[model samples]
Target: MDCLFEILCWNVRGLNDPAKRDAVRVFVASLRVSIICLQETRLNVIDDFLVMQCLGPSFDGYVYLPAIETRGGILLAWNKSLVNIERVSFDSHTVTGEVVPRDNNRWWLTTVYGPQTHEEKIDFLWELAERRSLCPGLWCLLGDFNMILYAEEKNNDRLDRFIMSRFRQFVLEHEVKDLYLQGRRFTWSNEREVPTLSRIDRAMVSVDWDLMHPDAILQALSSSVSDHAPIHHSLSAAFRPKRRFKFESFWLNLEGFDEALREAWVCDPGIVDPFRRLDALFRNAAEYFQAWGERKLGNIKLKIAMANTLILRFDVAQESRRLSQAEAWLRKVLKLVVLGLASLQRTIAR
Candidate 1:
């Protein structure tokens, strides 16, 4: 039989969207994996996956992605049956997380959020390479590394020498290898006319993990909602696919809109169109209003889909420590240390 205890790393975006993150979850759920590292939960204090969060009784959840940032960090969930609980740490850069199993287990599971830029991302990868030297033993690093290692990863951009160098360094230094490529090399892209495909998001393992799970395989699900597809790969002796979203037709199902937003998006006609960024606002608002009206969305989640029109206003991290109520609530809700785990429990989109 195929090996079990498989792990998945995905950019779910938000668990609330049925067509988006939820679709990806369905694909992962089919895998029957053990641990899942989720990124870009985009959750707020009020957001909840509800029934979706209760996947496994023995699993422990960790939510390092602050809801305030809504995009920069991550959420991790692991089955207790697979590994004993121990310690977990989120990096100061909001780009890496380390899970050290209890009782001196010779393994480290880290989900990395690589830097976004050409330079920053390489720096982050080197940081990973450096970490490998500091901590010996089996290491499994996965998630949206955000750097395409090859030209085949993107359709138009030639292989970036600098980017390639950094990735190679990490792999060479850590003795890491990619899980078998499942399908198309591209794991992420903006589904547009040209359709950019890049394999920036991936899972990697060191010699130790490779030996333990020689049968490991990395498969990318179709882009359903988010820009990144869900990745399912086996590790050790277990395999569990991420949960798929069963979208119910309801306005509450559509997230973002709080009790019917009546305010129309005001397009400042004064803005010029030459620069794509500045003119994007008006175009999106018009698009949102049109989509909203066409759908006649009654489901809350769908209604919130209109808010997706607001998604382009991307900021790396919201850094909401300034929000007193939000911070207090986090302290009460997330017990990463004593409990040894907590989870944002976001659903899949792409």
Candidate 2:
């Protein structure tokens, strides 16, 4: 049996606006949030502790912990109902604590919004990973990751890949699983013409933690007041199987390309001889179709069989021309072989 749980994380940008702060109060009051984290407070004279105290009556005995704020500020406001609020990293920043009495407690919640500079950011990620390692089970890490996993993750012309590489390596070394790249698109938006968006804010956990709370999910909420959207999620005592993202369809949707590929295929030169060339073509096409079926519809073997049936039974050329699922079709082929397949289709070369 799995136990259901709920959690929230956000980079409020700054804890300034009275309405925004009040909204925070209402949001906290509304839910049974086990863990709550915030970043970029942008505080001047107000103390971090006092700001945390603002969640006073709603949290019912909570604690305010600060992280090494670069310019603005970072805070971790936890619910007493959620866990035994104990301040771990306080005096500077990077504050974390243990959630109490384990019936099936998978991870200890730790929130951080690291610095922008490479050196400072690296230090923050390394330290956070180190702290997680100490626990050695399930550790839920949240706040502005300040980094992205893929090229699609960022919207800027300038993405520091070198620094991002280090950050990604740290994630791999730490064995943390990113939750944002699952189904959602962009989490934070610069709100431009195309809207420069990136998943700077995210949540992640260990494999063991995934095993405990299977239903854990994260989504960026609308940032009506702040620049960055608020991230909301819930967890449960269920084990969700690792679902691969449908990244193929993204590649297949190209302009005036499928017809060219088919022409190229017919012109792809049937590997010598007469019957052998046809056999090879059908076999290759069958395999590609099968692989595509497996990815989109599960059952690789069955999918392959179906592809074989389609190629062997149906009018392959006509079907291929009318392939509304061109992306899915090419993806399966691309997955199987890498030779001369680049002409299949692509996403405008990044």
Candidate 3:
């Protein structure tokens, strides 16, 4: 189990409007957010009243980098009771800090608003990579990155290979991974006559951070007020009961499963009232199945990730030239593998 806390990140576009600020306050309260990161606030300065109106009464402390005229700004706020934050560094594009939670566990968090232009975007990536070297422990970078990881993340436009490559390189260099997202696939929209959607807003965490908060999830909420949707990061509560035993579909494909089940079912001692005996037998079988599932399906996530990577590679290759016969067949096989794994996961959930 993990200690549950929710962090909400949004571009917000601007918070100067009273209605927009009220909407933000209502939204954050509704979500029960403990921490908030707002970008592109478009405010030259933040006062106590503005903070109170935007973040509400729950948040006790906040830090802001004021916007340069009307262009860029970043603000980070956290619940004083839940998180004790110490500012680490700040600039127009990012604010880095050390966050100590109520449990006394600490991590480094960087909230960013990447530059819009091509040259500036490249500089921002390099700056981020440099900053990553400062603190190596559980780290998370979250906010509007202003770029997408893959072509599929954008719709109604051709992918920008150069920008995508730079973003990919930054991830690889930093050894950070995108947390699996829930709800909407795209987090930002162009708000045009024909709207263009892209998942530019996201949360990326180090491998160490994932290990620390294994059950954390990122959700893309509806873009009700701003062009960019707010992203919520939720960590599970620390106290959780032992998981109930559930059958795994993949176990049926493994050898000796039936034999194992039979052995558990029949190896009952003589304390038998018929109903109690049956109950004991099933309990034993469930224990055996649980152990078996752990051994066999433990690496399923990694396997699925590998399959997705291969599929992505094939799709990218297909854009420029035809795939070879072997490549085409492998792509089909990988897709099936991914689908099968997903189906097995759904079965396990039931």
Candidate 4:
């Protein structure tokens, strides 16, 4: 059986807005996430209907902590088919649970939303440590810790040594390790005139949990509607088939492409079997197109830049004196070529 499971944690800021909720739905669906941990939902309460709308019908069960006034909240939702919830515990700042997979392998998951004030932050750390002690099994802790692990995790700000020391101590005493991140260095940004960035949101697993899922990886996704970027955790050995290359529409715009395709397709070395002949034709076409693309369209951006430079030079020349018939023709041709290339690129992207 495949032992691969994917969990996503995000400080969505607020899911109260319909647009933000839709964005969350789209993002989670795109990733094919199995479990979700959301922080700072800013909703006093979330019902089954709202969960269905936000996470789609796949997630049938959820445990959440309601926000206080306008502050912190935590929510944990899972697909019933993929995970079996053994128990759930929640406070103003956290939601902790024990989940067993179909294979009967069990693990503890805790999603936290640390307090902003220093004293409350200290209390939050100790509470986390206490939870770690209670759940003596493979454990995964994730969400907005509201603090940085290291000085480098924060940008354009002075690191608070006392806070960092305590946070470091908590991790050391608990024997938790970060599931190294990919994509961006920072997870949260203060959307200001001159922004401050920090890696406040993360996934940390117990030593045993690390051994259980050795191939686990964490990816930092782009922040679309919130100040914090979402983090996704999954196993590296997850099954995915190799993607087949498709012919791009832009390739048809290049010179000699038709001739190259025709030559590759018609080159028959007296092969008799229909299946074998078809395979050979396709192989030849792919090879021909790859070689042609490398030689002719090696770098589309560089070619576009060169064309732009030529156009600028001609414009400058026209300012000095009337252009020659050939120069005028060259300008018009360059404009058309630039437009064509840009349009082709857009079409290929889509």
Candidate 5:
């Protein structure tokens, strides 16, 4: 299938805060991925409004395994315009669905949020094996597995060898090829002086699935808030189309709007005739408005990116030492800025 299909798997830690939701939505919009698999939502209920907070309006279809009293949760949302879900089912740890992308055949996608305890981890693997038997066709799995296949996957060089062996054996027996992460070595981190980093999140596909989507690539994306880095899996490397420019009505209410337009109109267009001069004046005013809008309003996307960068900087510093009161407050303010800008972008798009 040459049709493009992309999935974003993230362990958001929690989605209860509006700022966190806005950050997720902004990142999701930038990537333009068709499907989203979020783990550890920690929300007892997943509603349309809550889902909108993360995926926006386009991704209207979803199936979630709710959190157990503020614990684990999994949410799988897809854009209906890009992919049609034939069937969807969920359990305690996963949300499985049969997805059919435009001009492509159907395949099974399972978004997992594995357990932490060793006993629970064993059961999680067993459940996956059972699910694999049921979905014997083209299958692809992605999420925070909460376990690594090798010691090198962790920074501390420490792991339960027995558990690692079992996980590796499962992958081999099931023929689930663990797709190589293209951008980063580790996906999770514990922010501390002596930090622990591990590659717990992954994207794995069955042999037949790989044969169908040979061009598929997995990338570890940077996260602003979450401890786990989101992984993006795509079958094609297509660039997203640029958004259409529109004159925002809110711009007309700005303090210097009239003064700016008058200044542009007064500019000489090097024209002699009165009629031609009038046309030139209008052209100049249009150009002025576009430039003025950009300056006054600023590019929301760029502002959001800057805010994320600042937040990440603060987070990285916190790994070694606690931020002072001023820095902590500034970090919180930056998050709010991101949330507000994201909401503004949505309004402009609408």
Candidate 6:
């Protein structure tokens, strides 16, 4: 049951607007992300409808901490088919849960949204240490920490050595490895004339957790509608079983398919017995149709991979700078293209 395990973490700022919610849905749908962690949702109440609006229909399991007034909310959602989570708990700034991925291994996932002020931030750090004590075994602590571990992480004059030391001490105590963002420097921006950027958002995993997903990749994606870029963490690729060939109904609907099939069926294997001759003819037709379909339809799986690669290129570009109108349009179009390709792939597999 080894399946794809990918998580998307973002400080979406807010999802009150329908557009932002729709944008989230598009991202989830396009990327086929299994787990989602959203910070600063700024929504006082969250329902199934809102979850569907933001994460799409596939993400059926969720837990959320409502905001105080119009600030500081967290939402964690996962696809039920891929992962089963239990022992869920939440406070003002964190959501902790025991996740069982399709591989049937158990691990803790703590999604954090650290405090802004100095005094409250200390308390938040202590709470995180406490959370670690409660969550044993392989653990993944991730999301917006709201604090930088190093001076280079932020492009600003403000540097809090005390807070940085405390965060580092916590990581050292737990022995969690920071799966630092690759290819991009910052995960958040103030979006000003002289923009303020920081790498406060990240994923940290215990040694055991890292062993479980040795090939995991972490990267910051372009933020289209938020101040924070979405960070993607993907485990090893999904295990795909060998595909069994099946006749496609759509093949019969093609223009010259009938003629091709007739030509294929007309081929004789030169057998004497009637039953054996019929069997040979059927096998010949199946082989010919399989080759013909390959030539005419092309490979849906390859197209899906190419589309995903193009989208990732756009996402990485968006992380550093805003994409052009044409590029944005193309990215959006590629999302739909991937979705259709995935559907066709599923149909062929069936």
Among these predictions, the greatest TM-score belongs to 6
Better of 2 and 6 by TM-score: 6
TM-scores for the candidates? 0.57, 0.59, 0.68, 0.68, 0.67, 0.69
Better of 4 and 5 by TM-score: 4
Worst 10 residues of 4 by lDDT: 235-244
Give the distance in Å from residue 263's predicted Cα in candidate 6 to where it truly belongs.
26
> Model 1 over residues 1-350: C-alpha lDDT tens digits?
32355677778667555455446555655667666777766554322353144233434544455544555646677665555434565563233334434333447777766666776775676677666666677777778877777777788865677878778766776678876677777888877888877887888887876776576677787666678887776644344575433432333456554333344344566666647544666555556655564465234354344433333222112352243565445443433321321111113221
Candidate 6, after superposition: displacement of residue 70 in Å?
0.7
Over 4 Å off in model 4, which ranges?
Answer: 236-350
Compute the lDDT of residue 264 as modeled in candidate 1. Answer: 38
The C-alpha RMSD in Å for every predicted model, in order, reads: 24.9, 19.9, 12.7, 19.0, 20.7, 17.9
CA displacement after TM-score superposition, residue 317 of candidate 3 (Å): 48
Could you give candidate 4's per-residue lDDT for residues 1-350 as a string of tens digits? 22668888999998888988898898888887778999998888999998987899999989889998878778789999888676788765888899788877788989988889899888988888888788899899999999988989999667777888999998888889987898889999999988999999998999988887877889898887889998888854555686555777767778887887788685487999999999988888877777777687666677788899999999999999999999999999999989988876777679
Candidate lDDT values, in order: 0.60, 0.62, 0.86, 0.85, 0.88, 0.88
Steric collisions counted per model: 49, 8, 2, 0, 0, 0
Q: Which stretch of 10 consecutive residues in model 2 shows the poorest summed lDDT?
A: 339-348
Model 4, C-alpha of 87: deviation from truth (Å) = 1.1
Mark the regions of model 5 whose C-alpha exceeds 4 Å error after superposition. 238-350
TM-score of 5: 0.67
Off by over 4 Å in 3: 237-350
Pitting candidate 2 against candidate 5, the one with the higher TM-score is 5
Candidate 2 global CA lDDT score: 0.62
How many clashes would you count in candidate 4? Answer: 0
